[model samples]
Target chain A: DVKVTQSSRYLVKRTGEKVFLECVQDMDHENMFWYRQDPGLGLRLIYFSYDVKMKEKGDIPEGYSVSREKKERFSLILESASTNQTSMYLCASVGSTDEQYFGPGTRLTVT
Target chain B: EDKVVQSPLSLVVHEGDTVTLNCSYEVTNFRSLLWYKQEKKAPTFLFMLTSSGIEKKSGRLSSILDKKELFSILNITATQTGDSAIYLCAHCNYNQGGKLIFGQGTELSVKP
Candidate 1:
C-alpha cells in the first residue's frame, strides 16, 4: 500500500508567523500536490510538483508556496500566516496508475 | 475551464435507506473519474471509472460513469451508520499528468 505521512496532524500559529507543513510518501511517486480544503470550496489545489525542483501553481496558489527538493518529500510553506489561511491542508502523491493517495491532513489554525 | 460538480451537497438518510450521489464534469482531457470516501482524516479511494455503462461494485457501494453525458452516479444500498462520510468526485485530466479536479463533495449522514 502507498503510505503518505504528514509532519503534523494539527497546528496553531499566530498571525504573521511562518509555518511549514511537510509530507512524505514511500511510494516514490513523481507527482505530488498540496491542497486546502474548506467547507464549501472543497479541495482547492495550492501547488503541485511533477519532479524534483519542478513546481506548478494550481487554482489557489496565493499566500502559499511549495518545495520538492526530493522525490519522497514535499513541503508547503506559508511565508506569513493569517487567519484566512486556516484550513485543513492535504498532501497527495499520484502513482503511475493515475491513482492519488492522500496523507492524513493537517488542520491549521492561524490565530 | 475544466471543472467537476456534485449535486445534493449534503444528504441525510436512515441506516436501511439507499442513497445516490451525483457528479458531473466538463474536462477537456478527461481520462477517468474517481470516487473517494473521506471520514475525519484522509480520503480513501473507492473506485475509478473510465468506461461508460459498466458499473463497478464493491459490496453495497456501486458507481457508474456516463462518458457521453459527462456524469456519474454512486449508489449505496443497505446503508449503515459507518457508511456516513463525505463522498468526493474528481476528474482526472490526462493533459496535466493526471492532475485531478475535485468536486465540493457530498456529505452523507446515515442515522440509525
Candidate 2:
C-alpha cells in the first residue's frame, strides 16, 4: 500500500506569518505535487517537484513555494500567509503508473 | 493553455439514481485522463483512461474516454449515500512536466 503523510492535519497562522507544510511519501515516487482546494474552484495546483532541488510552478503558484531536498519528502512553503490562502492544502506523489496518490491534507487558516 | 472542464458543476439526486459526469479537455500532447473522488480532503484516484473507447469500471463506478473527441464521462450506477462527493477530472500532458491539469470538479450530493 502507498502512504502519503502530511505534517499537520490542521494549522492556524496569523496574517503575514510564514507557514511550512511538509509531506512524506513512502512510495518513493519521482513526482510530488502541492494543491490548494477551495469550495467552488476545486483543487488547483500550487507547485510540483519532479526531482530533488528542482521545482516547477503550477497554475496558482503566486503565494506558495515548494522544496524537495530528498526523493521521499516534499515541503510546501507559504511565503507570507494571508486570509486568501486559507484553504485545504494537499500533497500528492505519482509513481510510474501515473496515479497520483494524495495525502490526507492540511487545512490552513490564516487569521 | 492546457485545460480540463467538467460540466454540471453541482448535482443533487436521490439514492439509486444514476449520474453521469462529463469532462472535456483541449490539451497538447495528451497522455491520460484521470477520474478522482474528493469528499472532504484529498482526491482519491478512481480511474485512469489512456486509450479511447475503453471503459474502466469499479463496482457501480465506470468511466469511458474518447481521445478523438477530447472528452470523458464518469458514470455511477445504483448510487448510494456513500457516492456523494466531489468528482474531479484531470488530464496529463507529456509537455507539462508530467503534471496533471485538473478541472473545477462536479459536486455530487446524494440524498436518501
Q: Which prediction has the highest lDDT against the true structure?
A: 1
The per-prediction i-RMS, to one decimal, reads 0.7, 1.2
**Tens-place lDDT digits, model 2, residues A19-94:** 9999999987889999998887878889999899989998899988888999999999998999999999999999
lDDT (Cα, tens digit) per residue for candidate 1, span A1-40: 8999999999999999999999999998999999899997
lDDT of 2 by residue, B19-80 (tens): 99999999999899999999877889999999999999999999999998899999999989
lDDT of 2 at B68: 87
Instruction: Give the residue spans of candidate 2 off by over 4 A.
Output: none
Per-residue lDDT for B81 in model 2? 96
Per-model TM-score, in order, reads: 0.99, 0.97
Per-model lDDT: 0.95, 0.92
